[model samples]
Target: MSCYDTNIYKVARLKAGKTQEGAAEALGISVESLKAYESYSRLPPAGVVDRMCVIYDALYLAYQHNRIASGDVKVIPEIEVLDLPRASIRLINRVIQFAEKRRDRELLTIAEDGVISPEERPLYEEIVAELDGLIQAAMELKVAEAKEL
Candidate 1:
């Protein structure tokens, strides 16, 4: 019953102007199955999620699904749904802030040699967090663009 599962699946469906029965038919699953997924009682398979992404014209749904399916591994960054203009602005801002902060120089310094020393750990963590922010911003922009298509 994670918020990611309930919120994104149901929200995306509704935002796409799809009723439960219609979305179920479009997804080629029973209404009960869709209900289970929407309620977070069961997670949908990746393949089903992929189809839903396309059918509902909501690509962010795929991103959310991948994030949820990753469990504790958490390779996917969390993202917010934004309008195209805001998404673009946020991504550009992230890139600008990263560059202005000399994150690349710091990261290069940290990675110049084979290993990260204990003293460099904090800086390395900061760089990694900034990179994650960049990734999340880019993903948000991508989702916004996808909605336009």
Candidate 2:
């Protein structure tokens, strides 16, 4: 079974001390969209899911950091900083954007007609290969960064 569910999102949002409106704004989505997601009426797209993970992870880190700074006497959980410096994060984001574009282009090539043209086949394959590589690189970078911390 997939680990993703609306309840997890809701719990994380509440834990982060964010109102629905605030979380929606931070996610660059309308409140209605957020509501739909939380209600399980609509599934988030792949890109949106990636952004969701990033946003929630950031919120978690911020919460831990703030709690520690505020002199909370509670046990401080071990926190990891997955966010790299601005330049690195920007580059990683660009790679993801590029991968998404490549994926769309590959889909269009395959969906152009009932059958992929002989000429389109090679191009489609190339795009798919590159897209896989790009996405894998991005995931590896994220995992490695998290591991380092």
Candidate 3:
């Protein structure tokens, strides 16, 4: 089954600090509509799902994990969401490690000079570009899979 078949909306709503009435109002959607999505009685519009990501990627990921754990969702490796608990865990971990090290080094540099020098800026820019590719790959994969479903 697709995660669209699961309680991901409800779970994500809660993870996003729920406040359904307020959130629904803010999103310019009726409370009933939000409730329907959470109950799995209605498929959220693509725009709503996209907006939800802005609120909580971790929660959405957790929802994906739940769907996979239930033995109902098959992850198409190349098109998978970043299923961090699976083999993708290694890649995700590497990204996190890379980011942490980059942050530490950048902080150390800034601590010394109180500003990024032109030379140091290029190093940070390099890290940013590399991370952007890795992050975009996962995001594009998610979008691709969603389109397929």
Candidate 4:
């Protein structure tokens, strides 16, 4: 994504009601450095990112950072700040949906032979996608809880 499209650092700082000078001071970096990070001209180090999460009270920044760093790899799932009750309900619904699909049985069957044949590839991918969804829901709930803290 282009810097214009993904100026999350600036957005998070702004959402936290911080000015550029204040955020820069709190982050222990120069205003230009903070601006670089916000503009995506330079990526902040992991440590700075962590401090930003706390300083800005934006835990989602961690997820955003990982997503940005991983790029197309998508090691991190896209998540949103949800209310506690909504997050809980969403997580429960995902669990129920996964269980209803009975993907566990299919996964066991696929793994029983210790190989994924061409015919099984599509099913395997579907199951993995469902599993990733479950993970994402759980992470969303966790983030919601953390935000409540």
Candidate 5:
């Protein structure tokens, strides 16, 4: 089933306090079209689907902000740090190796001072750290795979 087949459209309409006519008017479509969309009797065009997603996302954001403002909800944004498990190591290293090779080309040049500017330094460091992690993970995976063989 498509993501649109989920309750996102219904929830958005309810939250917007819009009847079929109102929603259709807002969306520049017929009431029958809106009904068909909500009931999934007919799938919308790709542009229509994109528009619907944008509208629903906006409505949801408004609802969230309103709730937070009125103290009806305490919003806590989540920060997730994903560390890839061992199985992904070879793929990761291959990607990093490719990137490092690309960086060695003229496309990744710096200024003649041989010193990276402050703004560029952080990006460089982040890239280096990511490549290092990928290489390390790949090495570990190769050893494990070798033992299995």
Candidate 6:
């Protein structure tokens, strides 16, 4: 038997106020199978893992909504701020516009070049910093959305 921590499953079950048998019925699995998972006697299959994630996400959202309604925590939808460099944003915009017009991968080459003019170096650096922020924000957004679902 593969030893895997079924922490996620246990947490989800607890959060939903479900016993092992109850969760197994909800998930269309045998109670013994659910017990095996909770005890780490066996690892769930890939399909079970995917289903568990979906169920957990839905349960998490419902829990959050309930908590908010009960005034347990202030309901604040998370917002991520991206402070990308103006120059980079402008360059990206220009590239997008060019691509829209010409519809070629060649234009992307110009965008990928690191040969910034001396005067544009500072702007480029700022854009790079902003790009980092943007990427972080996007990742955060994805996490938030996943939790919401």
lDDT of candidates 1 onward, in order: 0.87, 0.59, 0.60, 0.88, 0.53, 0.53
All candidates' TM-scores? 0.87, 0.36, 0.41, 0.91, 0.33, 0.40
Task: Give the best candidate by TM-score.
Answer: 4
lDDT of 3: 0.60
lDDT of 5 at 45: 62
TM-score preference between candidates 3 and 4, better one:
4
lDDT string for model 4 (35-97, tens) is 999878999999999999999998878877888888798657787668889989998998899
Candidate 2 per-residue lDDT over residues 34-142, each given as its tens digit: 8887776765555555566567653343333333344555333322334456435654775777666766767775887879788778877877665665554554345
Q: Cα-based RMSD of the predictions, in order?
A: 2.4, 14.9, 13.6, 2.4, 16.2, 13.7
Q: After the best TM-score superposition of candidate 5, give how far the Cα of residue 115 lies from its true spot, in angstroms.
A: 43
- Residue by residue across 53-136, what tens digits does model 5's lDDT show? 455433232322233334433332211112334446555666777577675442266545677888678767766665555554
Candidate 5 lowest-lDDT run of ten: 74-83
TM-score of 4: 0.91
Show model 3 residue runs off by greater than 4 Å: 1-6, 57-149
Which regions of candidate 2 fall more than 4 Å away from where they truly are? 1-6, 58-149
- Span of 10 residues, lowest total lDDT, candidate 1: 1-10
> How many clashes in each candidate?
0, 0, 0, 0, 0, 1
Worst 10 residues of 3 by lDDT: 75-84
Measured with C-alpha atoms, the lDDT of residue 53 in candidate 2 is 59
